[model samples]
Target chain A: MKTIKQISVFSENRPGKLEKVTKVLADNGINIRAITIASSEKFGVIKFLVDRTQAALDLLKQQGFTVAQNEIMAIEISDEPGGLHRLADLLARKKVNIENASGFVIEASKKAVILVEAADIEQAKSELQNEGLRFLSEEEIIQ
Target chain B: MFWDKKIETISRSGLERLQLKRLKSTLAGINKNVPFYKDKLKKLKIKPDKIRNLEEIRNLPFTTREDLRANYPYGLLAVSLDHVVRLHTSSGTTGKPKAILFSRKDIEQAADLIARCLVMTGMKKNEVFQNMMSYGMFTGGLVMHYGAEKVGLLVIPAGPGNTDRQISLMQDFKSNAIHITPSFALYLADVLEKKGVDPRKDLFLKRAYMGAEPYTEATRNKIEAIYGIDVYNSYGLSEMNGPGVAFECPEKNGMHIWEDNFLVELVDPKTNGPVPEGKEGELVLTTLCREAMPIIRYRTGDLTSIIPGKCRCGRTHRRVSRMTGRTDDMFIVRGVNIFPQQIERVLMAIQGVGRNYQITLDSLDDMTVKVEIRKELFDGKVDHLVNLQNTITEKLRDEIMVRPRVELLEPGALPPSEGKAKRVLDNRTL
Candidate 1:
């Protein structure tokens, strides 16, 4: 079972919030692989999968941004109509509650990888591996 | 026309003479009974009998809130507990509150002064007075109640809150006047508007005494327009016997400090020396008539100036302008004195709170404290952040005695101050 580290940055829901967060990462030469935002009325949390995970977390924290690092499992699925549906059905059957998720399609490989954050990440990794699913490692995601 | 016409209209020469004699007696009483004052006076090598004129008051040491808190419960009282008939406490900077002791004569004198204030504002015996200020340990309610009762007004002892009930009482009893805070009065006016109750037509309120908190003249005008009644400003602190320390007569000009009871001095907050006459400075007062506990040259922290010359109302007691600002970081929210340090203490004790925070006061007197969330505290869970916000709110409420809306912001969201940070943003017109 392989896992990738994801950095979550707490941000107030106001104008230029995302720009500030992204500017910090870009200024430090940290490339963001994938980004998603979970927001409420007053504030939001930005989840980022960057190439340099530890460096991004350290830099963000040093810049006085409220940031946290957590392990998330990124699973590769076939790039087709039922790709996400089939994976979702299996996770639903296996009782792997996905707390948050986001994905990006790779046109060259004709495959899509879904980033899954769950409380029981170890259990999800093992259960998905038992079903013969391919999971991306931190190095593979960075590449 | 006055509660104590002779005293209220005393000539400048006579008032000075009275103030000098009373100041001497106050010094003598505290010198003999209160060790705190006795020790302070002895260190200055001053005798009460040697104090001849009002100018000599500057020779006395200034008493501060810290001094009052250091003395605590009974340290400042000039008389014994057997002679003290009543006690009241107001919020202090720390956990311990400032206690004020009142002897039987002290209470009577307080009531008489309030009665004088009431009559000066045109309150009569037949008018129904609704006291909406808090009772119990807070002096606003009881002090105003005793005074209104002394004036023979049909006094209603309705404490603050329950806007519906307060309005209903005003309607049922035909309350002719009310003693309320400016913030609460605005809230009540909003409630009346929502209920489609026109105050002018549906109520019998002719005037209002708004005190215990600072407000602007524009706010007074707005409230007066809403209720169609004259809104008078009342100024007082518990140290100098609440709400009747100074009051506006029908002139609606600056409030006249009842010089017969309390000696008022305006001094530079930083220098502790008298500012030039009629200049804005911190208000320092001495309890000239109090028997049990006489605070001499007590620093009030409120910034105001003396309105030069006599008021057209014929009261010789000098007028002090409405408070401009505080010399310290203390702010009154919903009529509760709150120091930014009190909020900071609670935040600093908490585990996840960051160093920078700002207290914003809205026009309606609602306080919102925006605290920076520490980087380590963000665990990618909104529930955790919400819980942290609630915890800060509860702790601040316990410490400051006022519930504030706590906001968790990203670290560095608040503007970092270059040198001395402005921690408080008071948006209220006051």
Candidate 2:
């Protein structure tokens, strides 16, 4: 079972915060493989899949930023139409709630990877793999 | 280890005898020297000779903050203006600022009294003392400053609000003791950890004198554990010569009021009469030895009780428990009286609640308490977070007897303050 480390940063919903956060990771030579922002009216949480997970976590924490890291599942799927719908249908049948998710195309018009955060990561990973979906390793996601 | 053993260790009978003598002299001094007290005494048909015993103090009228405010600059002075040595004014965050006068003798005595308190708390003359309370008219700063100096400690008058400099000064001077407000102590603890200065390994702070605002005992324990220091609860107000009126001895049971310089009394705030011993009441005080402006029966709004037991330190001065709350600090929600300290006590006892919080009373029907959940406890699950919020609400309801809507805010969402942290906001129309 392979797992990818995802970093979540708690940030206030102020202008230019996202810029500052990306600047911290960029300056520290960490590449953001996938990213998403979950925001409310007053604040937001920025989720990132970075190449150097621990380094990015430490740098953000050293800058007085609240950061947390968790092991999440990253699956590579077909980039064709209904790619996400098929996976969603499979997880829905199994009642796997996707607490948070983000995806980006790795190979244009052919392949893509979806990062998922579920309440039970192991359960979701095993159920998705049993349905013949391919999972990406940490190194493969970084590459 | 005692600073003034003869005065501090006097027996109960001996203390009463001295109080009576000083009370007579003070009554005489005010009746003859100040026309305000003279007129009040004459109106009450009371004579200086009438106060022959300590029990007769009940006959005297209470001198309230309003009276102090009405007198303003010099109306309450018991001595001539030429003899007034120094002056310190209340912060006056609410109404007209009060001016407190101190003669040269008053200054020396206040320093001596505070020195005695420091010594009682296990502070020594050889240790380095850093004064972090604000200076300039805020009595907490200069009063403790003079007292630490008198105790023969190396004084670092590092005023509040510069956290890095405060830490560096402690490192530079190797300061072993500090005088600061309790809220600022919590803020400093946060800053110290952010700077990676583990107090146990990097600093030499062993003693802390915290007062000027009400704090829960849980707060005291948190500060002590964070820095590995003995944080003593200090009690005082500018009217009673600030920061030296009462302090905790080494036993940490309760703060011993130095009854030699000031006469302490506990009274029912509503009836303005004495309460039974060991009961919560308003703290009333009379300046016994003050020559410049000896206030009589000054009603301190702080609410506390006299602890029932004697201190193990052998000091004969009676001890007062930690101030629970101020009479003015209580707010009504659905006809239930709630104190901010009550909420604080409940929050501090919980595992995940952080130091900073805000209580906003929206109306009699709606009250909300905003707290910061510690970052470590934020598991990023909405249901888990809701459970934590419900737990806090239930705990607070159980403690304060009022159910308040609890909102869990992110870390650092609340405002940062170095002085008294404003914790309550009453947004009710009524």
lDDT tens per residue, model 2, B1-430 = 7999998899999999999999999999999988888988999999988777898888887898888998889988988888998899985447898889999999999999999998887788789999999898989999999999898999999988888899999999999999888888888887887778999899999989999889999999999999899999889999888888999988999899988787888999888878877999999999999999999999888899999877889999999999999877888888888888999999999987888899998778778898887887665554455667789989998988888888777667788768777889987776
What are the lDDT figures for the candidates, one per model? 0.85, 0.87
- Residue-by-residue lDDT tens digits, candidate 1, B1-430: 6888988888999999999999999999999999998999999999999987899899999999988888998999888789999999988445678999999999999999999999988888888999999999889999999988989989999998878889899999999999998767865775686588999999999999998866667667778988999999999988888888999989999999988888888999878878876899999999899999999999999889999987888899999998876656678998887876677667767878765688999955699999888776678976667778889989999988888988888766777542224678988885
TM-score of the first chain alone, every candidate: 0.93, 0.91
Interface RMSD of the predictions, in order shown? 1.4, 2.9
| TM-scores for all predictions | 0.61, 0.90
Task: After the best TM-score superposition of candidate 1, give how far the Cα of residue B135 lies from its true spot, in angstroms.
Answer: 0.6
Candidate 2: docking tier: acceptable
Q: Please report, as a residue range, the 10-residue window in candidate 1 chain B with the lowest summed lDDT.
A: B412-421
> Which is the leading candidate under lDDT?
2
Quote model 2's TM-score: 0.90
Worst 10 residues of 2 chain A by lDDT: A37-46
Chain B TM-score of every predicted model: 0.79, 0.98
